[model samples]
Target: MKARDRDDEGRARSARPRDGLGRPLPYGAPGVGRQPEGVVRRPAETVAEAQRLLDDGMPFHAHEVFEDAWKSGPAVEAPLWRGLAQLAVGLTHAARGNTVGGARLLRRGAVGLAGVDPAHGIDVAALVRWARELADRVEAGAVVDAAREAPVLGGGGRGRRLE
Candidate 1:
């Protein structure tokens, strides 16, 4: 096997190109640009950026944004961000046609989100419900459309209103 790439700190990293869904492509294949990890953002910024990516049907990129929030935000908010990240990944998997994997992650994310307080401006209840329902649909052989069903992540539950 070829040697895996490593970062400056010797942590495993890939400089590989990735499709919109974050799937690795051949070395020279064109792919989406990735957001740099560890850039801290305020809660609103994180939500807004993630919402935009989801609207663009780029759940994997949105997942990375939430991941940054989970890692760089306060410990208390880690679960919330992490749950959101997982939710995005679930969407990514579903869109890519990984039914079982998608449903599993969606359920996991919903479980994590269920325990969080809703004072963070995210409609946690709606998200949990959406995740559960989507998981069910996905399991029943529904085709996932990430953009068309992207959840409204902000606006006091009014933002990113789904059409």
Candidate 2:
């Protein structure tokens, strides 16, 4: 079969590219574009915004916010933001029913948070613990309610209105 053709099982081939985690890229989607590492049009200036996105059940958007911080913030703080972004993406995967991917990203995010200080406006330790627990549950085939389980950004503070 041709690369663009269906497989032997007759499954249609995907035309979109995939990210590192195998999530299909929504090319041509509104507000979507190819960004280089450390580049974003508007980075989240505070964890509160990221939290609001998560509480609103937009983990994918939350990931972008975190990614912007990771890429554009101080070098010393990159890992923490990157880890948070990964966790958000993991939640997004879980919400979409990709358990394995969710678990993997959760674990990775948890590990990335190791040795980070919590003074960066977020509770790093608590977030890591939550990520690990979520990862375990996902690995065991639990269905995650992303909104109900969304992480409280900025030291467990209240997030903005939910979606």
Candidate 3:
């Protein structure tokens, strides 16, 4: 049939159960073929999207993206992304006088970002150093000096351009 029809049929079939080899997963199956080990597959993507939203001053939307990714389970960077998402929401909260929530999320995000190196993606030591330093500053509770901090955080502000 048509592509849309096929997709619809697939979704419908996926709702039912069958034999193991080629069976459709029951609702909420932990890992369909491409799903992550314990988490759903989109944490990384979700994080990127959330970052985009956050840059656009859409903290609420970013929070939802991170929340959905966080629920996916055991993503390699889910903790980091979720923590960052929480941080964004916390910033929003703090702006609205929710210091408790903002501090909590920022603390969590810093912890989550520990030991991660953006240079791993491109093998650039400078980038890694920058990322590590940014994470360190965040954890140390210093006001993030974005201007001086940009190069150290890799790509001279690549994160901002992503959105």
Candidate 4:
């Protein structure tokens, strides 16, 4: 194909998928890197994907994906995804210097996650701690730090890094 065929109004057609990440998926592959059909997508998978997006600095996308899963998954697992998604969104906002939004979202996420069991992949205590810290900082009018505190896996705060 000629260069002109790849261009629309002088802008070259992107060879990559719309995600900032490079590469176009092959035929039948999902657009966002994960296929949505027939696969058993647990809340853990949704949270993990959300974490990846957050790490890539795409908080909004992360929140959206988790929200989708939270709405459709089992009730026992929905809060986990919802809470985590909000947490990521809050962090994104904080990174962007929006302390108020960050605090609000974080606290809301924590509230949404309260009383949920960790076995369901929801770390309620850690989330509550994170929310409290953020809320305190926001209340004191402290600057939002771009660095995110990592989530711990297991009761002893060991085993694996959640983010």
Candidate with top TM-score is 1
The lDDT of model 4 is 0.60
Local accuracy by lDDT, each model: 0.89, 0.73, 0.44, 0.60
Q: Report, for all candidates in order, the number of backbone clashes.
A: 0, 0, 1, 0
For candidate 2, write residues 38-120 as lDDT tens digits. 34433335476667667766677778778888877779888888898999999989878899989999999999998998755
**In model 1, what lDDT does residue 80 have?**
95
Cα lDDT of model 4 by residue, 1-163, tens digit: 7343264456565443433222255545555543232234575666566555555555556667767877777777777777877876776666566778878888888887788777545467776776667667776776654334434323323222443
Q: What does the lDDT read for residue 83 in candidate 1?
A: 96
Top candidate, metric lDDT? 1
Ranking by TM-score: 1, 2, 4, 3
**Candidate 2 local distance difference test against the native:** 0.73
Error of 2 at 68 (Å): 0.5
Candidate 2's C-alpha runs over 4 A off are 1-44, 155-163
| Per-model TM values vs. the true structure | 0.91, 0.70, 0.43, 0.60
**What's the C-alpha lDDT at position 5 in model 3?**
24
Model 4 has a clash total of 0
Q: Candidate 3 residues 1-163, lDDT tens each? A: 6233234336422334322122345556653232222234454455455444544444545556656666665567565556545555554444334445545655555555556544223223343333444444454555542222222121232343221
Residue ranges of candidate 4 with Cα displaced over 4 Å: 1-40, 120-122, 145-147, 150-163
Clashes of 3: 1
Q: Which ten-residue region of model 2 has the weakest summed lDDT?
A: 29-38
Query: Is 1 or 2 the stronger prediction by lDDT?
Result: 1
